[model samples]
Target: MSGGEAYVFAAYLALFVAVLGWLVIHAFKIARLSRELAELVELARRRDGKAPAPDAAEARVAGQ
Candidate 1:
């Protein structure tokens, strides 16, 4: 292949690698957030000494 064709192929491969890396990093972030939310849910359950409610926390915040 010509030099120009080789350069084009290399550019495309680099772009593909970058996109895949970004997807992996984003997935890791999502997993971390999910773990944090679960911890918060557990803390809330203990704080109120009852089962967690979907709206109860929001209502408490609004009332404050």
Candidate 2:
């Protein structure tokens, strides 16, 4: 491949890697948020004297 073409390919590959890394990080953040939300719901139930709702993570963990 020509030098310019190699540079262009490298740039595109770098961009793809960055986007994929972002997607992976975003997925982790979402999972963490769901777990946190479940914990918050439990805390709210305790304070409000209501029954605790099912945790959002239970099904996902159980399926594994």
Candidate 3:
């Protein structure tokens, strides 16, 4: 391949890798947030002295 063709290929590969990395990072963040929300639901349940409701879980996730 010519030098210019090689450079273009490298640039495209770099962009693809960067986008994949961002997607993986975003997935991790969402998982972490979900775990945090589950913990909060447990806390709220203990505080209220009853089983947690679906609405309560939604509210906690919404930061209400």
Candidate 4:
């Protein structure tokens, strides 16, 4: 490819990589927040004198 075409391709590749990295970081952040929310819900339940809900592993086993 010519010089200008190479530069354009490089720019596009850089932009794509940046976007992908951002999405991955965002996904991780969401997962962490979900875990934190679940923990908070369980704590609230316990504070109210109720049994904490089954976790993911127990739920999966019960589903089987």
* Candidate 4 C-alpha lDDT tens digits along 1-64: 9999999999999999999999999989877766676777677778999887858534543354
How far is each candidate from the true structure, as Cα RMSD in Å?
6.0, 4.1, 3.3, 4.6
List model 2 lDDT by residue over 1-64, tens digit each.
9999999999999999999999999999888877776677678777899776565435644354
The superposed Cα distance between candidate 4 and the true structure at residue 19, in angstroms, equals 1.0
Which RMSD does model 3 reach against the true structure?
A: 3.3
TM-score on alpha carbons, each prediction: 0.67, 0.67, 0.71, 0.74
> Clashing residue pairs, candidate 3?
none
Choose 1 or 2, whichever is better by lDDT: 2
Clashes of 1: 0
For model 2, what is the error of residue 57's alpha carbon versus the real structure, in angstroms, after optimal superposition? 9.4
Across 1-64, the per-residue lDDT of candidate 1 in tens digits comes to: 9999999999999999999999999989876766666668668787989887746654554354
Where does the lowest 10-residue lDDT sum fall in candidate 2?
55-64
Candidate 2 contains a number of clashing pairs equal to 0
Off by over 4 Å in 4: 55-64
Q: Go through the candidates in order and give each one's C-alpha lDDT.
A: 0.77, 0.78, 0.84, 0.78
Query: Residue pairs in steric clash, candidate 2?
Result: none
lDDT of 1 at 44: 74
Q: In candidate 1, which residue pairs clash?
A: none
What is the lDDT, from 0 to 100, of the residue 25 in candidate 1?
100
Angstrom error at residue 60, model 1 = 21
* Regions of candidate 2 where Cα sits further than 4 Å from its true position: 1-7, 55-64
